[model samples]
Structures are given as C-alpha cells and as structure tokens.
Target: MNKSSVTVQPLRNTQTKIAIIGGGVAGSTIALRFAELGLDTTLIEKGPSLVNGPPICHLHAGGNLYREISDEQCLTLLQQSIETVKVYPQSVNVRPTVIALPKTDHGQPEDLLPRLEKLRKRYSELVSADISNKVLGEPEDYFRFYSRAEVDALVNKSIPSKATQASDWLISFANFTDLNKLKFPVLLVQEYGLSAFRFAAIASLAIERLPSCHLQTHSQVTAITADEDNLGWQVSTKLQGNDNIQQQQFDYVINACGFKSGEIDDMVSAKRQRMVEFKAAYVAHWPQCQGLWPEIVFYGERGTPQGMAQLTPYPDGYFQLHGMTQDITLFDQGLVASSLQSAQPKLAQRFIEKIDKKWPEQLIHNRTLGSIEHMAQFIPQFSSAIVAAKPLFGAQQIPGDDPELRAADVSFHGKHYARAEIVKASSALAAADAILANLSECGLITDPAIEGYLTEHYFPVSQQCSDIEVTERAILLAKQRDYPDALAKNL
Candidate 1:
C-alpha cells in the first residue's frame, strides 16, 4: 500500500464540521479515514470510553469474516483490522483457530492432506508460508487441515482415545454420538482475540490521535435537525459529565451507533422497532497454568450440523467457551447486563456435556452467573456462565430507511449517511469505504486535483488496526490462474 506524497486540505465545509455518532469499529474507522484525509471530524461516544465494559461489550472478530466473505475481501479487511488493533492499549492475542470436521466414513489421515492440497491448488494465493516441518497458510498463509497427531503436538498433550479414534480432528455434526466418525480435516485458521475494551480503546485512540479529529467521549446526542441555513444538519449534544448543552452543525452525519441507530435516527426518520435474541455461554480461568489452548470451533457429530461451540483464550489465563446458539441477534444496550445475569445455564452447560465428557471437574473458583453449573462438574477451570444478546444480521435500521444496506459492501447516500449492516467489527473495513464514498459524494471531501490519492494509497490498508503478517503468497492453481488478479475478487 502507498502513502500519499502530497498534503491534503481540510475536506469538509470548515464551519459546519462532521459529527460521527458512535465509537465502535465502524464509526471509529470512518473517523480515522476522514481525519487522515484532513477533515475536521468530531466523533461522539455515549459511553465513558469507546468500548465500554461487560454489563455487555466482550466481543470477538476474525474467522467469521474469513469464512463468510470472499478470500480477497476477508484477507484485506483482516489485514487492516490487525494493524489498527496493534495500538490498542491492552493485549491482542494472535491465535490460529481450529475448526473440527467429523467424518461419516472411514478415511485415512492421509486423506486430509489431499483435501488441503486440493484447496491449495485451487487457491494458491491463499496458502500460508511453511515453517520447516509444518505447512503454513493464510491469515498469514493458506489455512491448513491438521492431522490428529499435529493437533496433539499443538496442544502438547497426548491424543486421548476419543481424539485418537477420530481419523481427523473435525466434528462436523452439531451433535456427536458413538456412531459418528472423527477422521476428517480440522481447519487451522489465524484469528485475533481481545477484550472489547481493548478493541474500543484502540479505536478511540485512532480517532483522537488523528490531528484533524476531535473525540468527545461521554457525549450523548440529543437531537439532529435540518440546518438548511448551512446546507447541513444541526446537532444537539448533552455533555453528560459537565451537564452542559452544546449545539453544532455538520455538513454530513454518519450514524454508526450499533443497535441504537434507529433510536437515534428518530429525530429525522420514521420509527422502527428493534429486537435482540438471547444466547447462553460459560467462561472460566485457571491459576498457575500456562494457557496454550487453541481456539476451537466445533460443528457436530450428530445428523446435520448443529451449532458450534467457540472457545477463546486470553493472556490472563481466562478461557471463554461459548457457541451452540448460532445465527444473528438484535440487542438493546440498556438491557444487556441484567439479561445476561438473568440467563439460565441450560444452553452453555448442555453444550459442554454434548461436546466432551473427558474434562476434569472441580477446577471451579469463580462463577460469573450462578453458584452451581453443569460445566463446573466436568471442567476444572469452568467458572461462571451467562447469556449475551447481539444485533441480528441485516438489523441496522433508520426511521426513513434512506441510506439502505441491502448489500453492505458499499455505502448508500441520503440526507443522513450510515453503514447499516456493519454490526460486526469486520464490516467496518468495507463500511469505511462506503462512508468515504458518501463523503466524497456529498462534496464534504472534495479533492479532485489528487482524485485517486486517498483510495490508491490508503484504502487498501486503512481498516487494519494492528500489525499483520506480510507475505504475497502467489496464486498457482489452474482455475485461479484464469482470474489472473487476486485483488479483483471481493465480497
């Protein structure tokens, strides 16, 4: 990626300014881009900091994008997010997640290598670099299929009979039984894990660190009205800490306030109802133990695939295990805390029992939600459990629904702008592009003399928040060769 050689003048109408509501990944990245372009940007977050804590707020990124979107889009956005997150004040652990696939028929362990090799042949550009004995793949290189032996080596533990019985490391079905097989490939993927506080901390830092940007934390937006006088909108903000009220104007406004987007848009648009579904999960921490746990996403061994269980480990020896409930959700920020605490341990505990029985019980020291939990009886480190709510997929909404997100890869332009589908962190990358397009379209950021300057130099990598593994793994497959350019494919 190239950096611009020329200086940029302030992009927006100097007096009106640009008010960005929300400080999550979507809003923060948008703020980062406008600021870099030399725009006078004001970012407002209702919370004390960008990422407020867990009455809600513990979040995860990676794999979801890699698996759901195209390889080009996934890799590019992931790279950008990785870079931006490096500056997060807290620790961001880089870990490769392993997804298990269960076998239905008896297949040799040798069969796993061929499958990955075939993927390698098909997507030569996606392969990771090798490290002497093991074949590496993307995140940095090609995602690989690890054998059971390799899995054992990764965990530094001997293969248990339950593990050894499976020819491979995958468990495809949602539910496993004595009949289901385990002799297939386990997907080894590169992913990142960090506290939402850390994620938000870095994002807030990016907004404030930019010379042209002003970050207003704990600033609640009370109203937005048309200011045809200035050909923009008048914004009313109540400074929570000072109890002071201030009115400002912006040439353009972007609503990236997550679930509350519609609630905020009510000042100008129609009213829309918001909803969120509940999900149960458990977490625990072990003392005096070195955590080498690989994040594992399990499918199932039962009939058709059941939902998966995602296990993430932190630097603080706090290991979180959740999943089982899948699909999207819509949440109300105010209810997140009480709801999670009120959740029963049924789902999370059932997931633990359904997956494995070998976990040693009695390692319980702290339980986050309840006194007696089923997971504690099997896993020594099993602590407390709770349920969480998330914004449902395709849930971002505004009253008028002017700037739509039918397809979220880009932005839609209207009186007020928004990246409507950016409910997750990864969506921020592409949504940033959409926001820039809107800014440029609204004439708030006009720099035609160096027209392609920003897009050419920074767009490719702006979304990254942390350092990334840099390598140009070339495309080698026949089908892949036909496309010729790997950059053309994006989701």
Candidate 2:
C-alpha cells in the first residue's frame, strides 16, 4: 500500500491497565506516558498533593539522571526534561544556569591547576559534540572558561573585603547567560521561579493517562499477595483516618516508593538480600548572609572538590545552599536547622576575620533563615522478568487476629555509611566517558566514535560506592518470583 493510502487504525481491545504505587517524578512520568498512549492508569501518593514550584536542580541533578545514560541519550533526556518542564509549568522548575569552578583564595596552590586542567578538558569535550555542545555554548559561539585570577577579580569586586580568607575559594559557578556571552551569577540575580506543586501536578497528569490507573492517597499499602492460579497480584492497605481496610489487584505492580521499597518488598514476602539506603542532606539560606560567595563555590582541603556546593537563587530574595554530607538521619527540619546553626557562625567568623585583615568596608554577616532538609532513598530499576520470580507477597497474618507484621530489617536511616570520595575534575569527566563506553559496548547505539572522544578528553579521578553489586542483586530478587538471592550470579 502507498504510505498515504494506508489508513492507521487504533487497536480495538489492546488497552493496558496499569497501577502506579508512587506519585513522584518517575511514577508520574510513567503514568503520563501510558495514559497518553490510551492506557488505563491510576497513581497513588502517600503525601499531600505535590506543590507546583520552580524546578530545583536537586530534583533532576546529575547523579540522579545523567550518569547512567549516553551523551546522545542524555541530550534527548535533557530535551524531554525541558519540554516536560514547559508542559507542566506548575509541576516543574527550570533555572537557566551554568556551573563554574573558581580558584581558592588561600593561594594558587599546586594541586589546583591539575584539577582545572581536567575540568577544562572535560568541559571542552562536552561542548565539542554538536548535540551536547548546543547545551553548553553561548550565543557568541565561544566556549566559556574561567581562570583563577578572573574568578578572584569577580569575587573582590562583589565582596571587596579583607576579612575573607584566600583559603575560602569560590571554585564553581552556575550562572544564567543568554545566547550571547553576557553572564551573571545566579545568587546575584533572579531568573526563573518554578513551583514544586507544579511538578507534582504535571506528574499527576501523566499518571492519570494510564489504563485502569488508580491513585490512592494517604493509604498505606501493608501487604501484597500473588494470585496462585493467575498472573495477577493483590495489595492490602489501611486507609488514613479510617478503620476500614482496602485491597487492590492488578496484573502487574511497579514499586516506585523509593527508599521505602524494602518495606514494600517485605510486605509481599519478597526475598531481598542486599538493599542499601544512602542518606543525603540539603540546606537553603537567604541573601542577607555576608561573605557568601557570589558563585557556587566547591571547598576541598586539598583544593576544591568537583561537584560540591550548589548555590542557586530561590524565590523571595532567598538562595539555596546544598551540601551532600555523610549524615542520613537529617531530614527537613533537623537538617536545615543544623546546617544554619553550624554554617552561620563559622562562615561569619571567617569572613569577619578576613575583612579585619584585608578590606574592612565590605565586611558583613549573612545568616540564612527558614532552612529546610530533604531525605531521599534511591532504588535501582530492574527488568520485569526478574521481579516476577520474587513477587513481593502481601503481609503475613498472625493467628491471634493481630494484622501487624514485623517491619523489614532495613531502617531508612540505619544502612551502612557509603563513603563520598572527592574526585579530581578529570576523574569526574572520565567517569562520564566510561558510562558512555559501557552504553556503546552494550550495543544500545551505533556510534563508537563518541567513546574514543570521551576517553581522550576526560580523565578518571577517585571512585565512590554509588552502586554496589549487592544492590543490583536485591533489585533482581525483589522483581522475580523464582530468582531469589540464591539465583544471583554475583552472589
């Protein structure tokens, strides 16, 4: 048949019925895609409806999304992400910002240059690719670069005080620049404000599109039961503020409950051998705080560590300062309050001392107000075949009419402390290259040239325990009915 003459007919009975357990970005996005494709979909959220807000980098930062995918795939993802932001303006936030690394004020130390060279090479390689470079290039068509001296000059002009120590270096910068070369620091200026609610709303929109989608809010799913004679599963839940119990059955179940996946797995009697929960802390402050670097500055005793502090301007004359520390128990209130209490005094004292020794006129104390903390548990995704073998069975019943099951062995905050290694800039770039190489090797794409370019341009630095083989095995076990920990190849 001729292309124009061929009539496209919609499937009469090919609709898919889907149920999403969480309403976060991933779940909501899945829901939307399925719904758009005319599937029956429902999304359940444990918390209140998501508040629409500006897209925070924390929600979609590098380690969260970019690390696993190839450059071409990443670009496509980034574009889709940007488009998603536009579609759900209320549910997403996007700040047109660029990251910069400034020099330490203590001195042009020996170890600093090598780090810069590594960063420079990686930065160049990213821009060298036509697709990736489009995201990095300025309107003037020149690549952006910063020297230690230039960063210092900008700092002096902005702060202009003797109290700031040279050791207090401003190494990284995330600025908003036009297609033209004109650029300004995010803290010094305001660009976009996205509501957190908006992101959640858009996610809801996406989830609603799935076939047979059901979203239960404030309903705690306590158990999962697999059908003995069919390919289906049942979920048991206790409704919030009600004595009544509820149950749901579906052909398939996707547990996107994040760090809480282990508990959900236990409810279904799914055997999960190795699930690790890593804790992260975030802090935000207002603009009145003095001695605050204009650009996002990364601090390392040996010099500046790659990807440390992320300083971004928030709505209502406030700025968010994010640092990923080793502590996992610290969440919203505790994390924010502690960061302000600890950071304010030390930063103020340092800035004041530097001012007393250097330029006196610019000395000021900048204290952050209204601090907030967030704790997230990341669980890796596994194939469906793996999950079917270890179908998370619903909670076990006790003989004495008690419906409670013991909690899972894993505590949200009690997992082993994963060490954070400060990688050299070159090393960070090299890791990205390695990820690209792996993607190429898997035959996921046709391009082999990108891997070679990534190798030549980026250098590898220190490695951290972001992903452990045990975690992957746990994911596989949780997914399947037959492949328990005993079936794991690595184990």
Candidate 3:
C-alpha cells in the first residue's frame, strides 16, 4: 500500500472535527464520547488495536489498594469507577476483592476502617440518588470484616464450586493462605476486575459502527503543528511500514497518548511536567486450584522486599499477578521524569525494547517466576503455578511527579487543545467529560446532548453490543493478541 499526503481542508460551518492522538483508554473514551455527540472524529492508534498499553486488571474502586492516598481521592475513584461501569458494563468482571495486611506490615486493619466507612457511606448516598449506582452491590455490603476465628474456621473446608456471596469468594483464600502469617480481621471490599482487552473490543467495535468516527489503527502521529490561520491543527501521521506521511487538519486536537503524551506536548511547545513508570503483570495458569476466587491484595511497602502483591483471577483458572517489588512488577529506573530540555521522560532502552519489540524468553521466565515466588510467600499453593504466557506490561504516565496521585482528569493547554492525564483506568470517562466541557466552553459544541449522562438512565452509543457479542469479540481479541482466550471472559 502506497502512502501519500492527504490533507483535510477545513470546512465552512461544518460540525467540529476532532483528532484524538492515541487509542488507549483515555483517547478511546474521548473519541467515543465525541462521536456519540455527532462530532466528526478521528482516532489514531500506533498499535494494531486499542487499549493495549498498561495492563489494568483491577478497577481501583474506592482506592482500596493505596492506603496512603486521601479519602477524597478514594471517593473520586469510587465515583469514577461507577461511571466507567455504567458506560462499559460488558467489560466488568463481577467479583469482589480481599484486602489483607500481613504480619510483616506495620499498619493494622483498623487503619483501613475510616476510609472504608467513608466509601460505604458515599456509595449508599450514590445508590440513593440513583438506584442503578448500586453497581458494586448493596451499599450495606460494600465491605465486610472477617475475624481471625471466622477465617480460621474455613481453613480446613473445601473451596466452594462457585462463589455467590462475598464470603464464599474467600474459601480458597482462607484454606490456602498461611493464616498465622497475616493479621486479624481481613476485609473483603466490593472492588472488581476490568479486562483491558474486552474494553478495547467494545470501543473499537462501537467506533466502527459510528458514521462520524474514523478509526485508524497502525497509524502513528509523527508531527503536530498549528494551522497558519491559528484556528485549528495540522496533524501529520505515518502509517506503519510506510515512509510517506499523511497530514490532516482538525478544529481540535487531544493528546491522549498514554505515557507518550509529553511527546505531543513537545511537538506543540506546550510545557509539561510528567513522569513515566514501566510495570508488568504475570499470567499464571493454576488449573489444580479449583473454584472461583475473588481478587486478593496483600499490602506491603512498595519497592521493598515485602511489597504489595496482587492476585487477580480470570476464567479457567488463569490468574494475573502483580508484585510491587523491583524484582517483580517494578524495575530499577523504571520510573523516570521529564528533563528540563524535553517534555518526554527517558526510560531505559531495555524497557523501550520490551515495549516496542518482544521480550526475551529468558527475561520473561525470570520475572514471571519471580512474581510467582512473591505470591507464594502468603499462598504456598501458588508456588506450583507455572508461567502461563508472556506478561501484560507497559509504561504508564503520571501527570506530575507525585507517584501516589490516583485521581486526575483532563488538563487544557489552550482553547483548542486538551491533554488527558488520567492516573487510573476508571478516570477515563471523567477525563472525557472534562474535555467535552472544555469543548463547550470553546464554542465548538454549542449544544451538548449528553449533559449529566453518567447519572441518567440513557444508553451510550457504545452500548450497542449485547453481552454475548461483547464476550465473543473480547475473547477473539485476547487470542489475537497472543493472550489466553480465558482472560477476556469473566470467571
């Protein structure tokens, strides 16, 4: 296929044209929202598909994983997660999460109560405001405490065939975990799992049906410059395996390129302060471990010998694992910041190689086995779990230097440009809404149709797919990406 420069001439009195850079969660969400509003939109993705950046298995509903973050951030996360679920209900894996503190940790379970209580109360209020906001289950069941004796009682019992209630999800955990190694009164919260691949499937399929939205995969944005009239932007893109460039003009440009947003910022001479961190999650197939399981979190100090360990379960006994230690999920110099001269942060080339090319088999084996060993400290049976496939990993961008920052939306540069710097996957929709609000303020959108869409009962344009269709497409996407088909389906 020969590539040639094709310019999109600015139309007179036409619908607002939007060019969204990157096809990750944030960009895809913004494009979908714009297309739903009947705006002429183009989604440019460097990869073959969408949402293929960092692996986001766990939805940080209530921000339970990060105890250091403020309660306000936790509440924001709760609200964002609710909105995300409403928009992509088919992408959610309906399961709870177990949060426990090991004996080696300094903090107690009581340290978590205040936040949990606040989350529960907020959840109750949201449900009261709109009954459908009860996506995390009944507010009363937002979180439940399990005393040591109660958990100990199930230590000798068999794992339930299927987990119906929150406690039922703990049978295997209680039986397999070394009870003495953990603190008392473990809490099970209503946080759930999100399949990135499934989300990509939904967004791509939905965009394909929208007449106003153009989906361009394998098209990388090479250069961006303001038009001579100063009314719009001229975006130059290069197709994969092609030397020629194609330039297009749009009324507005959104930088949503995940960790590479700063590159675009530099292209437009927009000053920014950002950090990028590379992280990975291992896939382990433990077929012998029968029965359904809730996602488990063992909190410890980050970047230490005893760091946070996460076990996320998928269908068919395939478990996704994350260890916050440097030897496992994190790496030395994995987190880097932008320099004074350039807006983009420089990660080590080895990480860039892994991101752009394939990971060496030896390195995959070492890190994955290391992740398995990290989990085996609490659950001994997990030691028998072998590496299932290549890890799900990518570099994520933190808008500011604060690594602990969890809740963020979109930031605007000028009247016609916006940058989405969401820290969590749940925050994608909120960022898109912020962009829409900015567009309205800039007079690009005179009349907004989906105001307060999150709280209302109306369906999103992307909700055209039935549950079964979403499942089938998601599973096919997983297989195409070289992941196990089970990862796309819920347990």
Superposed on all Cα atoms, model 2 deviates from the true structure by an RMSD in Å of: 19.8
Task: Give all TM-scores, in the order shown.
Answer: 0.60, 0.46, 0.95
Least well predicted 10-residue stretch by lDDT in candidate 3:
1-10
Measured with C-alpha atoms, the lDDT of residue 194 in candidate 2 is 33
- Please identify model 1 stretches exceeding 4 Å from their true place: 1-16, 53-92, 101-141, 149-183, 241-244, 270-283, 288-291, 300-306, 326-413, 456-491
Measured with C-alpha atoms, the lDDT of residue 412 in candidate 3 is 84
Off by over 4 Å in 3: 1-14, 448-459
TM-score of 3: 0.95
Candidate 1 lDDT over residue span 325-370, tens digit each? 3221111231121122221111234323322232223212222223
lDDT for model 1 comes to 0.44
Per-residue lDDT of 490 in model 1: 10
Order of the predicted models by TM-score, top scorer first = 3, 1, 2
Count of steric clashes across candidates, in order: 48, 80, 0
